[model samples]
Target: MERKEYYAVIFTSKRTDGDNGYGKMAERMEELAGQQPGFIGIESARDANLGITVSYWESLEAIKHWKENSAHQTAQKLGKSSWYEDYFVRICKVERDYGMNE
Candidate 1:
């Protein structure tokens, strides 16, 4: 069967200096996101100061809800104030995808 269209939230970031609780918060955020409705999956990678996390969602409304989540909001504030030097978030509609395992 063909997969339906979905949304991917691509979050790219540059770290400030040290962990300072970032690792714990990131783990918590991932756990919370998995519990949310319409969450598909997530992938993340980091090297030195740069990081990229791509979270899949069923729709735009789902993404909006995730953004409004209180814990996630707190994390965002913390990212700006403490952990991240800079970041970018891009939402893309995925109409088709191909992978080796599939």
Candidate 2:
């Protein structure tokens, strides 16, 4: 696959020390997401009070399915109640993309 289309999700959060178990959750999410139909790949980053994760997919439906996934829902709950003080998610369609692999 050329991976021309992508869902760019930006998540910003206020993380708590003990509750921000991102290392484990991130790994698990990546493993699960890779198993989903239409999933392409993901890129992510984080800072003191912010986190951004972008995942690529074949269609809107695939993205929706991931959003409604049970594991992801559990993560969301943990994020809201414990890990994150606040956060945001945005999905966008890619019209054109260019890159180089070295």
Most accurate candidate by lDDT = 1
What's the lDDT for all of these models? 0.96, 0.80
TM-score on alpha carbons, each prediction: 0.96, 0.83
Query: How far off is residue 76 in model 1, in Å?
Result: 0.3
What lDDT score is found at residue 36 in candidate 1? 97
Off by over 4 Å in 1: none
Report how far off residue 25 is in candidate 1 (Å).
0.3
Q: What is the lDDT of residue 37 in candidate 2?
A: 95
Q: How does candidate 2 score on lDDT? A: 0.80
Model 2 segments beyond 4 Å from truth?
1-3, 100-102
Model 1 per-residue lDDT tens digits across residues 38-85: 999999999997899999999999999999999999999999999988
Candidate 1 residue 93 C-alpha distance from true site, Å: 0.2
Cα misplacement distance, residue 81 of candidate 1 (Å): 0.2
